[model samples]
Target: MKKNKNLLEVPNINSSDAQLKKIIYKVEDNIFNRFFNSFSKSEYLCVCSGGTTSSCARDNFITLDLRKEYDHIHLEKEKNLIKIGGGVIMKDLMNFLGSQNKIFPTGLSKLPGAGYLLTGGISPLSRRYGLAIDNIETIKGYLGNGTFISLEKNNLSSDQKLLWEGFKGAAPFLAIITEIGLKTFQAHPIQIIEGFINDNELSKIINLAEGFPENLSLQWIYAQDIYIYILAEIRNDLDKEITKKYLNKLENFSSLKIKTYENYNQINFFPKELDLFELNKNNHSEVISLLGEDLKERIQIFIKCMKEIIRSKPNNSCYVASQQLGGKTKEIDPKSSFFIHRKSTWKPWIYASWKKDDLKEKEIVLNWMNESWEKLKIFFPKIHLAQIHNHLNSHEEEVYLSFEERLSELKTLKNICDPESILPPL
Candidate 1:
């Protein structure tokens, strides 16, 4: 296959574990081992299927492409578990699971790799099944030091347990995940309710979300024109009656545009392609806000701040979006993984884009996003790691916030497994 010029190319690894180890030894001896003495000589990146939303998969690094080596998806019907390679995309996995009448909470976007799970994947089905990271059973990966490790949650040593915890929501910094085993659930029919709602109905939307059943998920996107595009997913017919009963309340405020799907394929979840602009590598600005107890009040502030940012946007493509995160996602034990934003009911984020060659426009958008974030952050202090890439803001601080109380432990794991800092810095 012809490689994309925008991406880094590496030799394909199509061999057994023994041969793979020899390749790793050779590569380490020739390149990675040298990083210990000269950290600035060359940067290294682990690109798994190239689905990263960030520019971390650029040509500047010595990229280790895992797509060719690990792109298999195996379903074990007896065990009710599915083993997915790091290279597998959301669409491929969803299709395979849907074929077997099974499902796993994963992101709606089709491009993101299993790396999405490492950042606390919030899916349309998450309200019932919990975050993707919560379903993980085993992780097999190579550390920055070229050591291959396989860990199971059911059986772990003290040190292994710590590393596992760090890997759950912060895997990029810890290792290159080759494959993972996750628990699966039975697939169910879905009902999609979508429409444009005026700003006045924002509070009613929040009220509906507060009482949402576990089988329902809500997503609201604030467009550049100030209209709120609301999309909701109802899991199955079992909850269809109650779901419609609550949705009926939305009709009082929103103009309805409802649709239904028997399975995942019928629903359109892919993002629209922007032809004129691209994500600004140096100036891309984004911030995730975790809504507190005052949902309605905080959402009002969020909408106002987003409107201000949108009005002053350097480009017409920039907008704000949010995902509901309160049902089964909130029930997961905070201590189980590094992702600790479970108490949050909503995750609102700001995104800024610019013309490919317009440096001035990039700067303006970045400044506006940052300034707007500062004004709105008072209402929601916590952050989600998935949407907040390293280049967007204070990289280290964002990593610190994602890990929060477990920062020290994660750092210690980094020291032990990646002593040379061969991998990209968080």
Candidate 2:
């Protein structure tokens, strides 16, 4: 593994406090803050992928960066398994896997951390194979006091499986993850195809997604119903002809522009090992959360709302679009820690981010996202899976507090694992 240029390397655990202190002084602020913050909390809100968890933590409890302090990976080349450090970032792990021509499920963004995903993940590839933790072989962490233990597939005895089953989707309780032993795969060839629909041809957009194959996953984004983005991932030769099939169907819509990234694996090979901090660290100009049905009318309605929001904040560069919770993901036994939807799962988020100083603009976009969330509640009731964490805008926040039982369980795990609360807490 190569050293990241921007941050100094963390020394092996054997170093003296004086030496460790000197070494840590040279790293980046977020990473450093996160590293020290991990152990400082007698209780903490640990954060990984989505930024909101950290935001919420800062407001409610003591928080820290688990990315450095807790995330540890130990690769066993002979065993064909890697004990991943809890703090590992998404790009680093995916890129590492890419290098091996291997694959694991990942969220819409290439930058989310593995810590967040394996515990409660929703990835582009999750539909067919499984959610992040669905593929897990084992989990190793703490019940409390820095004592480490490993949970393996063999440990899923009838009695233990019952307890483990209860912990999925809910936050961690009774343990803090130090590392996870994950099942890895040889690379699967893939392709990326994107569709852009014109404002008027919106009906066809929904039709296209509805028609996507089991092997193909697509996301539709409506920007005031005027700008719609649909991104799809196609596995090798499932339909062999879906490429042309989708292209032709999309053409029926007026003013549609599409980009088909054939042989996408060739472009984004496994284990490419890109640095995560490099990617996620660059926040988008604008991100406002929205909720909508995977269906077209809901998307159109959301887009109309977004158009008004984006128009006011032109700097808002992009909105994340996803079709969440179809495929085998829904099929997975809801009991596994891998699956976490209390209700219907919407597609990936349409995330928007702006500069630090853009308070007024930020307020406008965030309010729009919240308003969009509230506006769509009636339609959302139709979804039977689970709502994602990010969409819990102002109103959604209250709704999420309902999951406290599960969350409380996760917190119990944290207390037991890092009684000092040094590890990241959800």
TM-score of each: 0.86, 0.66
Q: Best by lDDT, which number? A: 1
Choose the strongest candidate by TM-score: 1
Q: Which window of 10 residues has the lowest lDDT sum in candidate 2?
A: 12-21
lDDT of 1 by residue, 1-426 (tens): 334433333211110100111112122334546544544544445344544454334334434555666779999899999998877777788889888987777765666777688778877777777888999999988787878899998999987887888888878777778889999987667767665666667666766677777776677766543333334444546577887787677676646566767765546552444222234333333344444333664667666666676677666656676777778878888888888877877777676666545678778877876776676567657767774354555566667666788888888888877777777666
How far is 290's C-alpha from truth in model 2 (Å)? 6.9
After superposition, candidate 2 runs with Cα above 4 Å error: 1-80, 144-147, 157-175, 221-236, 253-320, 338-345, 348-365, 381-426
